[model samples]
Target: MEFDAVLIEPRRAAMIAAGLWLDKTADDYFDACLAAHPDALALSAIHAATGARRDLSWAELDLLADRAALGLRALGVGRGDVVTCQLPNGWEFVASYLGCSRIGAVFNPVMPIFREHELGFMLKHGESKVFLVPKTFRGFDHEAMAEGLKPGLPALRQIVVAGGAGANSFDALLSNPAFDSQRATITRDTRLGPDDVCQLIYTSGTTGEPKGVMHTANTMYANLAPFAERLHMGGEDVILMFSPMAHQTGFMYGLLLPLMLKARFVLMDSWDKALAARIIEGDGVTWTMASTPFLIDLSGAVEDLGTDPASLRIFLCAGTVIPGPVVERAQRVLGARVISAWGMTENGAVTTVLPEDPAQRAAETDGVPLPGIELQIRDREGRPVSGPGIEGGLFVRGCSNFGGYLKRPQWNNVDADGWFDTGDIARMDAAGYIRICGRSKDIIIRGAENIPVVEVEAALFKHPAVQSVAIVGYPDDRLGERACAFVVPKPGQTLSFEAMQAHLKAHNFATQYWPERLELREALPATASGKVQKFALRQLLRDEMGL
Candidate 1:
């Protein structure tokens, strides 16, 4: 079965020759890990809402994974099929992903926060065959929504509810005796090669469309070793993952990284700071990766509890700059090496501070590129930015980088020199550490989540009272950014913030995507060509807030 993805031959050949793209999949490492440490802990799952814990050994998880694969097959899922799973951080999510990888099915993980507006587009575009979600999560009926949308999606063949009664129940399917009987015939397929695209993740692009970022096993594996080696991670180290497994940050380092290292990981279904702080000390969690707000909250919780989370050694935070005070306090309180980093859905954690670097380095820069990757800054003309400390568009090309966007090979956007435009503005110092200055993508990195500014604006265009609308982000101390909509009302008509929100709710947008504040304007500042001048609007908010 052929998977849908773009694989440039020369690049793949070069990476393979250099041994960077190890012709191995997560299944290979998982088997090796089981052989080496059959009795060792593989997952420590804690439900954030319930404070419930479940621990599984590597051997047990492997068994469940096999069962899950059989269950998926029974539902007509096969090689190269797109299976979309919308689950929080839990054992079920882990099992589903592993099952997909084992059977050469492309796992498309949807963030739980997405509602019909965002999710409908993705489900339709990917032509997903099987969708997995909890019966209910965070007070939302995910199963009900999936069932409602199924009629509209002809390719969506099955819906597997994680916690519900029925023939399609996820738990019941995994525990079926018939699948266990077929275990004897379950041979690892040699044809299920590392180069096959195993993952499809959607990231919002500048055009207000979600781009499906595809990754092969080799591309992802290339990122793990160099990153782990530089941080001195090993089988002995303990990991805690609080971020959603849907994001590449959490997906790669949280799930697959632990499997490759053959180490144990704790899954936090929600980001509960108090519980996380307690888990660190109780579980001896040594390594974690999250965004700025998490580090801030965790440090605060540690201080409040007056507990020394000495087991935590590395805390890698990305998506925004870490304030100097936050970094210092987190180190002083938690005793973890704070690492500032930057990455995209197209590539996972391309830049990160070294373990040996001083705390001051994290505050000053996002850090240098990882192994098998190269970073360059270029101008509008595509010429390399001449000197260090000069701000320009950042470009990245690496073995870990993703293939062309799903179904749109022309959107690969790589230049003749093989550099993919990162859409971030940055400046590299003489020391090779880069500081992110701005984004050309017109994006708002609110906390770790990328708020699709243009998409939100387009949604508001449905509002009858809205004559013109533009969404711009204002600085927030904790979340890094918060969207505020500036609008011009239709003549002789008025609009209110409540009305605007009601309109978005009708459109089925997630509450997180709604603009927090509304500002009325007589007219918007635009160019001669009538394109909205977003930078000027951002400056307007900055000046009004005295930032």
Candidate 2:
């Protein structure tokens, strides 16, 4: 479906006027590689658990994509249809994405860790026509879960399975008899364009259900172009990506960016610092993009396991704040440049520290906004604030900025002037660098995925034993933060952590959203308006944790 002109015309005119919107699509680059240098290594992977490795050259990958595209065509998936893939980091995801792009279908990636609750909403909301899942991943029966969800998903016509028993096997699809004819059909009149939607990545906000962030080919290109240029990435570089492929960081840098640069990309489906260190040392890895936890674990692995990652050069850390001392320690221990970055699924890599940025800048600030993007701070009343150190709401507008959330006009999260409210409180220095101080929204970012605080609290409030509940983030040295629930039980009632977790499970909430720690409180701090003061709760926890 075409985007509403009201959302497209202004952003399009601005981006085109600035020459930031490249008219090229991702398929265009891969198609060029097929003709010029098909033998080049484009993607490599080491299983996060099994330690098995798989490598795919550009020619092999492109051919597999053609067959997958044919398989999709046979299933009636065409332009504008959504293909949701919940596979781990592997060649299957790469093939699915390429095939979808080849046929003008939108590729939607679901995190492997997400269960029935998350998948049910995303697939139904996205109107996914074809859903792909690994039969089993990390010991969970994803195939069974997908089958159970099929009855509720009216638009889902096919469920393709990878590496396990299912109605359709991914391996057999690669050898489908219709592949050649379908390839010809796709090449005849490919309707995909730069402004066409490429992906619909869902991310949680202050709300309960996650919002699908839409990105067109041009928007993604705008981000990948600046990232590659700034990092000076090329075919010679080997990227070790431990972030989930479903997340934007891994989706862009780990999956698409390497293909764009004709470089080697290594991925780990699960995060294991010891395994990651081994990959870095064995594969001659040069750079990676992940969150703070990965940095901490890798640093520890280097020191404790005596792993030599001397070939690693740059580590782009995002998802959460990196403690200043941790950044200093990472540089000294890993012998790599620790670069800080801040971005969301709505726009990939909006602001990031440059390769040559000072260590202090990387630690103290989130870095400057990339070219073609504009960042500003405003007060609660929406008036622009001109200052160096004053904290205000952060807003951004750029070529890479997303158009709107899927099927939610009221939740567009943007103003009439085309600025997106980042929901972050930040300060901009005189030199134009931004430092995020806190969040203006009620959400906790646990290991890069946002936990909808209100949703969880609302569910917990339904419990018979609970009187009042507030959820807040507690500092953690590894994960950066974890959810801690403070509950005031009803008189003559007691709530245990096990019972609370059981309640959440019964409510069909993802385990990741469940509070890790439970604290019993006699009363919670409140305001004159009878609303819970979460800041007080957070501060109390901070003091208790001595953070």
Candidate 3:
């Protein structure tokens, strides 16, 4: 794929001039960091369930990465081959990613929760040659699972396990001294450029099957450089990351940024808010980037446990519409600036609230684009909307944007002007800040009227018993489609349809906007990134109604 066709020369030059686009790949920068501070702490991993802790210095991590790279090369995992890793957030994941980069192999990190079906599609689509997995993680035998599917995967040559007895042990790669002699040859053969594909992240299958989003080192760094600068982060800052390394939010900001800034990263493979509070106070964690659920849960935990979060500074929230009350309460309790952000697997963090921005903007809007990124909103007729507060199809163009999806060359869904439709209905304020309403496909059209899902969700979020809420559409004979509310109630609380209707009515919500049906659930179906799967809810409703 020629990135020049999508990203023109002038903008790329401007980005480089503005210091947003570094000319170096991530591996080159990692080597520089190793040379500068070999003894500095590079990563700290915490087992979320057992509370076991491990720390690695830059020197130690570099050695492990070198050995891992050599082991991969010995297994025929050469340049341009996809090295798929399905491991939790730990030192092994870090080693795998850096090792792939070292040998010019594409790092494809699959979520641990993904089973054979999802895993099969991703490995096949990525054409992964060498696959890595934990021997057993979260009670699932990953080694056995991978071995079960190995016969069907002709492209997969090896299955490397992270722990326990397995076909190949990841620890052996670290202890193997034979690779020391092959360093020169390995360096000579592992040549890679800034434009070479470094990461292949699959989108969360919210609406459908995931797409293999391909990103180069330059493209990933374009977002990370400006993000670190905007947050005023430095090596002194310690980052606590709970989002899985497979997700882009965690992959780019959580894993990649630490290497760039030479900062310390604290990884948690699971989400436990109480443990998070303890880690924050004990380790002096200053920053984190995750979805709204983490922010919401952590705020509650801090208040309940009376944890001292004075060391925590910034929280970047994404993946959903954050209710205003949740943001206000979270800031008051967590003692951190709740920064709202919006991005997808196709692009890294494109829009984010700055630390200096007003608090109201953080609660009300999703913030403006970073340098090298541009957004435009268009109507149904492909005409650009002129004024503020008018909702339209959102399109974006930027250097941080992806070049194309893997193996889907014909699916380059971009306009002639190079703007990619975000598949979102959004409105831009006069000051250029964007507020995402919802996905264009998720909107419920009831009798020629569009039900604003964000507004309804926000309003319902204020209800006392409502813990989480999602509004999905159901087929209706008269209205073509009607709104259905899926509610997860607070603990020890139960809600009824009559009570919900009265609550919305008392709050002055219109009848047309009110959900016609209410269904109580323990939890809403969500992607690993915390995005609600409305299509799954719609499917359930259809199945129940026999539509």
Give the per-residue lDDT of model 3 (tens digit) for 195-225: 7778887764233445778888788888888
Per-residue C-alpha lDDT of model 2 across residues 6-77, encoded as one tens digit per residue: 355567877887788887887887877677778877778778788888888888887788898888878899
Q: TM-score of every model?
A: 0.98, 0.96, 0.80
* Least accurate 10 contiguous residues by lDDT in model 1: 1-10
**Where in model 1 is the C-alpha error above 4 Å?**
1-4
Candidate 3, residue 128: CA error in Å? 0.6
Candidate 1 vs candidate 2, lDDT winner:
1
Please give the CA lDDT of all the candidate structures: 0.87, 0.85, 0.81
Candidate 3 segments exceeding 4 Å error: 1-19, 173-181, 204-208, 441-547
The C-alpha local distance difference test score for the whole of candidate 1 amounts to 0.87
Minimum summed lDDT over a 10-residue window in model 2 is located at 1-10
Alpha-carbon error at 107 in model 2, in Å? Answer: 0.9
Best first by TM-score, ranked: 1, 2, 3
